[model samples]
Target: MSPEFYTISQVADILSVSKETLRRWDNNGTLIPERDDGNNYRLYHKSQLEQFEQAQLLFQSNWNDELNIKASRPYKMLELFAGAGGLALGMEKAGLESVLLNELDKHACNTLRENRPDWNVVEGDISNIDFSEYHNEIDVLTGGFPCQAFSYAGKKLGFEDTRGTLFFEFARAVKETNPKVFLAENVRGLLNHEDGRTLETICDVIDDLGYKLVNPRVLKAIFYQVPQKRERLFLVGIRKDLISNSEFDWPSPYHRIMTMKDALKAGELYDCDVPNSEGQKYPKRKAEILAKVPQGGYWRDLPDDLQREYMMKSYFLGGGKTGMARRLSWDEPSLTLTCSPAQKQTERCHPEETRPLTVREYARIQTFPDNWKFSGPISAQYKQIGNAVPVNLAFAVGRSIIKTLNIIEKNTAMNKKKCA
Candidate 1:
């Protein structure tokens, strides 16, 4: 059963807004939270949220009905930066077939091949690869290219101006393949990177390449049944000539938010408890100190003397370093997972244990399947999982993309019949 009152974070996850946005709304009296009598926590009632369109769709969603989505035909996908096959797995689950995948990391490549021996996993730098042979052959081209700044010369940036960046390689692939559709995934920070000029340049490049882009939308992973509060920005594009035949729709939210309990324990998300696995350990002193901090608590919850001891000279620093010494709660979604869980500024201690989250626990939080084994050393495994788009989140997006592709496919069939 879920709680009646919503925390600021829960509301943010449901409405897909930032906590700061909720605070701004509070100040403006658009939506206000009643203070809890026990702890003075700001709590929003469901009645306060009834006016929101996002809230309405979430509460009234037919998620089970939507799960029946199936591709009209076998849609072939070619992907770049295919780390640990997270997106590929999701695409497969959504009934898409993979013809090729390229990645620079040998460990991630090994992981992919280990799990899917049939996939054509190309292990090398993407810049050296030629995509022209697959021109007009691929149904979709996808890449979660790293974000890098393009030098501005005081003029509107063009496609060539983005040279020397990984994004350029992605654009090069799109130019060569000429797929019906393409998806470019990036971190949410890309929206405001370099005063938003970076994304502006990307948009301009897509337009120059003769593709009509859907307005980029940032999808919150938690909204799509991922039990962690991870967010990814997705840019979907249609080859301009094909844009009129089909419409692209973003995936809908699940009926309810999933909690950490749903992730690690046996329940709706998984059929069994997370198996034991290797994880980072805290120093003796750190472990003792962390034991005192309750679940869901952070550095500020420690005793004052211990706080000074733990924080050292940094104790007097301004602003809430809320993530430090943080412990997760079973009842709420996790903070975003990173490449390392034991990092001092972003501790991800287990709910019932004092140590950092195990590699498998990290995988579970990312919605990777229980049987989907990760290859490489422990650190490499963590890196692969951390950098991945959640498998379930990717599946949701893949289904929506398939919906548009089915329409385009039917139109093409009709056109061919007329020509015959």
Candidate 2:
């Protein structure tokens, strides 16, 4: 039978709150949990959760049905900053064909080329390349360009003003290719970057280029089959002429939040147990200290002296340095992966092991296929995986975009028949 009572971790997933927040609620007598007789673990009865609207939504979700999405026809796409093909691979799984991809990193390019030999991988700086040849031939243009501010200088934003930034190169590609649609992916901080001037200028530039900007959304990867708490901001735009016929919809969330158990084990997400691979090991003293941390525990879980010894000056600093000496919990999603697993500020220790996550483990957490290999040193591989969009998250977005494009295709065909 499915679960009637949920653990604190499971409830956190449904309610979208941290365990610490839930604990606070417990302390305040907001919602008390019934203790499990077997192990004295806290378990919230299902009846206690109906008060939360988010919990109710999970009860009535239709994620399995949403997976029926498919393309009506082959839609061509072009990409910039295509690192390790994460977004492109996900889009392909959703039925979009990549005509070309541009990247400055030779390693990421090699990884792409090695995986998909037929893909047209162009390795170079975006500004040095020309996208004019693909004009009108491409259906969509996508880029995860770096977030950089364009100086406002008390003037209205325009295409010419974005010249010095990578976003400008992305805009230049959109202007050159005139794709039916385009997407610019960035960190969620972009929404508030420069006190929101950056996004405002981006909107103004989209207007100048003859596209209608959909309200951008910062999509949480965990909601879209990724077993990590990563968020990426996606800005979807449609050409002005097709705006009337286009009906874009964001992908529906899965019924349940995926956890680390689902990711690393041979469960619903994968067919086999995670393969043994090379990973970074902690020094003897560091490993001994980290081993004291229980699953889901961080520096605060340590003894006072160990905490002081490990955190050093950081222990006295303000703000919850939760990521320090952290050990992931199997029952919860992994924290967002970073460029290197051993980074002190963003440590991602294994649940039961005292080592940094392996490269393959990092790839698995990012929702990359087990077979997909990175072509670089271990550190470089981590960098590529860390910077990638979660493949399943991209698949969800790609399917939604394809659904919109299918409507545009049918509407255009009907119009052509009427003209004939």
Candidate 3:
């Protein structure tokens, strides 16, 4: 059967143009289509549009940097706090091998093990794990260690001062493994956490561990094929010896944004619609109220009386109160996925459903493949998926890391030849 019809509005979005422009193009006979049903809604057959170079560009350019990675050796990776394996999986997809992945959460660990039984899923506190065994064997150490305030008692905090924080454990592993490169990730808030002293201290610790820190940058997920506006600060370090010889390039952003529709439907991100799976439900009255919200609309869109009734004292508060009753739009990247979809402070209601997004929906928004199943109860699954890095974004970063490794390896070989 032919694909389902898309309205002019949908076509405009797929082309990243306005509906009026699409209409103008239609009137001028620049863009025409075949008929569909009785309603006479201008239906463009998916096949008729295939010859358009722009459409081909959209398809060809989808996740650009991810598709064009330079050739590099298959470097081994040891990941710490590897939640749900998003970064690890993306790196693996980019050709890095996950020699070991450590996570404290049983559910996340189980999910990792269930998906890839071959992975060395180390389920425990990273502080207790001895990474020294992987020394010289692993080429990269990566993690999303939780951001914590450093005990900045002196001019420069050293590795010992970082003890007691998970980042310290990450550092200790870097020290133990002495990998050629390391990449640490965290929320964008880390840039200003404790008024920036925390990050300065992190840089200091990486330096103490004999690695030269790259000027860390926070990358927007929406620009990297993640259908969400989540921003993460990436801290990259190269062993000081390699930094002198190898040039590093951060991944370039894609020209397009992957939106909610791209995530849930079969257009770009996946081959089919998001799978039906478990999701959080709103209370009856709340769901009834939220049903009135238009796609892309939020609580402020509610009727005056309903707004007062639902929001109570919050109605009088200062900010836009946006997330309170937000409905997602198909054409825009979703707001950052939170740990819980239906939380009062950070609601992510489904585009069509009155309830919160399902675990599978959340996973798709994060660019997880459909076959990659999550373990544990429904709630636990949601948490694991929600907390993950978007796999596509990770892949883009992974390609950059691989490029850095290639340069380093090539320089090392050239140096050996010179000595010989």
Candidate 4:
């Protein structure tokens, strides 16, 4: 069965509200929590949370229903930076055909080839590839290009001004392919990068390349059925000619919040418990110190002496530093997975066990299916999975893109008949 109670911190994270706000609500009698007898800690009941609009989505019977949005006709896609096939797999699940997938990492390309032997996985530098062959043929072009700062060499940044950056390559592909729509994903920090000029420049470049940019949005993965609290910024652009005919909408959030329980157990997300896989281990001293941390607790929960011993001079520094020495709670979504689970600064120790989460567990948290095999050494495997867009989240976005295309296709068919 699912959890019946949640701590204040858990509730705050789930509702995307600050702890201070939760306390204010409690004081105002807007949303009160029950007090624990042992320590008098505030605990919120699942039933009480249902009173909230965000929480109410979880209780609706149709919350997890698949939109099953399908392509009205044959639609092909060309994917760039196809890391470990996370986005490609999700788009494939959404019924889009993968015409080509390009990646620089050999391990990722191998993983893609091993999993989907039929896919045309191009393994090389993206700068060397010619995308013009697919021009006006492919339906969509998608990628998560790495963000790089643009040189302030010009007053008004245009397509040519962004020539050296990875985003430029993404834009160049969009220009060459001239797909009906293109999607780009990046870290949430991109929204405010370089005081927002970076994003403004990107928008200007998209316009220069003959596309209409949609209002970019930062989507929370937890809201879309993934069990991690990851946020990604998405930019969708349509061809100038098709912009007037297409209507795009963001995907709806899942009905209920999924916890670590759902990711690891045979619940809604997976049919079986998380499979055992290789993972990094804590050193003897580190393991001994972390064992004292309770579920949902972090470095602050340690005794004063141990805190100093573990943290050293850094403990004296300011900032919450909550990710340090942290243990995840079973009833709440896991903190965003990092490239290294056992990193000293961002530890993701198991809720009950003292060790770090294994590879399969990490994949499960990212909503990668159990059968999806990642190729490479342990470190490379972690890097690939950690760097991936959550599959379910991508699937949700892909469905929205498909919906827009469906509308555009219908309108085009009607116009062709009228012209005839």
Candidate 5:
């Protein structure tokens, strides 16, 4: 049977707050826990937690209320920088058909083609491709283009001024396809990249291309059912003509946060425990040192001598450097994954095991289904999965996009009837 009460740490993880915050809340009488037999340990009854906003999501009854939006008719999407099909898979689950997917990486292209043989997987440089043939043929054009700084000659940047960057190519596709809507996903850093001028220029370029840019929002992946604390900034643009009629809404957050357990174990997110697969191993000395670090701890948790030895001169340096020698806790979300999980500065060690997260485990954290086969060498596979937009997060956003398209479709049909 499920436990009747939760410890302070358990409640903190469930609410995604630090223990200190819980202590403050306890002092404030916002959420007071009962003392155990010895009057030492604080225990929270499960029923009391139900009153908080975050805890409400954990209830099955609450999940049922979230909108189950669907595509009214077949909608087509063209994806760029489509790595290992994470976003594509989510969009597919959300009922959007992929007409064409472009990726410069050979391995990623092969992975896409291998999984969905019917998808038009375009391989090689995006700059060489001409998208005019797809003009007005697609419903959405989406990409997670790499953020690059534009060479501003101190002039007001416009559509043509962003020519040298990959974003320009993305914008070019938007212009050529003339999709009813388009989405661009990038790292949260893009919001303040080059002191926010890059994003400002992107907005201006979107306007020049005859698209109305929505106020971009940074979406926290953990809030969207992904068991990783990844943040992605999304910019949605609607074609200028459709802007007046379109009503676009961001996807709602999932009721409760998913934990590492949800990703790897047989739970709501998956039907089976994660299958064993290849993963990187730590060196003997490193493994010995890490064994001493507790789950949910980093290098700082090591003994003073070991800390100095393991961290070297960097130990004297400042900042938390929390990812180093870090081990995940089963109850909390995993850290944002990187291209290499075993790297010293950003280790993603398994919660109970000494080694790094396995290839399949890595994929699981990113919300890729068990059957989504990744191509190329193991390292390439890791890179592809690491670089992907979390599949579930993408699905949530895709559902919102579909809902907006449905409204647009209904309005268009109504206008046609009026003309008749």
Candidate 6:
């Protein structure tokens, strides 16, 4: 059986507050519960808490204990454009504390706040927020800022050239915070975006801001324990000053790649098969057409007349159009999940059923914990899950950050000793 009672320290740790604060709240009747053996020891009975609405919610939804995963030291981070807290939660699991997180989406913000009450979530446009408050305090800064092209004013695009784009805010935050390191993650398309000039300009801006950009690499998530064929371009930077004695290493790939079966079934990923949950339904005729496609097959597998019927005007268009009517295979990693599973251009059909993937399946592919509830309508939840960085990928990156921070701390301590 689960423990019948919790210690003062346990409750404080779960709520991410202090024992003194809990005692004060208990004394004031703000969170009053029964007393222990003596009146001096204030104890909360688990049964009585069921009646208190707020306490009940706290009892059910807390994740603070999971936050205390192994780490050499607590490193602080300031994240920009944090979506659904995927990267933040992953980093937290890897022992980095999210001192502040900024996200513009209200629904995503609600998801973060509902899960972590103490987190300082700034829910608004990044342009309006100032990073000066975090200056010199944050050990690292990170953002998956959207890619946009800036009109080049000269041979080198200065900070002014990127003023209107979201990347400028990311650069501005890095410049202002002057952290020991920062990481920028983007879609793989960025490497070739704008005939590659856009990425070149971004690198120039980062270099101009006085950071050493590592040879940016596209890390495939399938190599990192994420059960989806997702690829992201990771641009890691270290403040020029910190690069002398330390080398930053990206997380090593897991020994084995996880397949779609590993994601949705009850095996390595979870103890039980996915819980039945709501999922998108294909149109009746579309479902019938897709049902004919074998596992791992797409629209091309359909009969010629059905393909012509489904393809419509697009049948005459050039290129493969491979995403149409695709069915995932149990043994293969899923093709990158799209925002709308039912979209014709990018269908991720269920391997067995002709329906789109269920919400739980989507979360599993993204490596979100089963109990980590999202907040919103079904569509909103799908969008949030689809847009997020896979939590395991984030955790892998977080471990690298901790490793780098450890090196920085050691070097700093050595310098101090020499001065002393």
The prediction achieving the highest TM-score against the true structure is 2
Write the residue-wise lDDT of candidate 1 on 1-420 in tens digits.
Answer: 125678987898788787889999999998999988889878998888878998898877767766888899889999999999889888889888999999999999999998999999999989899999999999999889998999998989988889899999999999999999998899999999999999999999999999999999999888889999888999999999998777888888897788899999999999999988898899999999999989888999999999999999879999888889999999789999999999998899998799999998999999999888888899999999999999999999998889889989988788889999
Weakest 10 consecutive residues of candidate 5 by summed lDDT: 58-67
Which stretches in model 6 have alpha-carbon errors above 4 Å?
A: 1-70
lDDT of 5 by residue, 1-420 (tens): 137777786687567787889999999999998888766777888898988776665543322333477789999999999989999999899889999999999999999998899999999899999999999899999999999999989989988888979999999999888999998999999999999999999999999899898899988888788999898999999988887678888877776678899999999999999999998889999999999999889998999999999999999999989899999999778999999999999999999989999999999999999989999999999999999999999998888889889989999888889999
Model 6, range 160-196, lDDT digits (tens) per residue? 7889999999999998899988988999999999899
lDDT of each: 0.91, 0.90, 0.84, 0.91, 0.89, 0.83
lDDT of 3 by residue, 1-420 (tens): 134445665466456567678778888998875555676767776565567664555446535544777656678999999989999998998879999999999999999999999999999988788888888888889999998887777678888887899888988999899999999999999999999899989988888888998899988787677888788999999999888778777776665567899999998679998889878899999999999999988888999999998889998989877788888998677888988889877889999878899888999999999999999998888889888988988998998888888889888999999999
Q: What are the TM-scores, per candidate, against the unseen true structure?
A: 0.93, 0.96, 0.85, 0.94, 0.91, 0.82
Better of 2 and 4 by TM-score: 2
Candidate order by TM-score, highest to lowest?
2, 4, 1, 5, 3, 6
Q: Which stretches of candidate 5 lie over 4 Å from their true place?
A: 1-67
What local lDDT does model 3 show for residue 23?
Answer: 79
Alpha carbon lDDT at 420, candidate 2:
100
Worst 10 residues of 6 by lDDT: 61-70
Determine which window of 10 residues in candidate 3 has minimal summed lDDT: 1-10
Model 1 spans with C-alpha error above 4 angstroms: 1-9, 16-45, 418-420
* Greater-lDDT candidate between 5 and 6: 5
Which residue pairs collide in model 6, if any? Answer: none
Model 3 scores a C-alpha lDDT of 0.84
Error of 3 at 416 (Å): 0.3
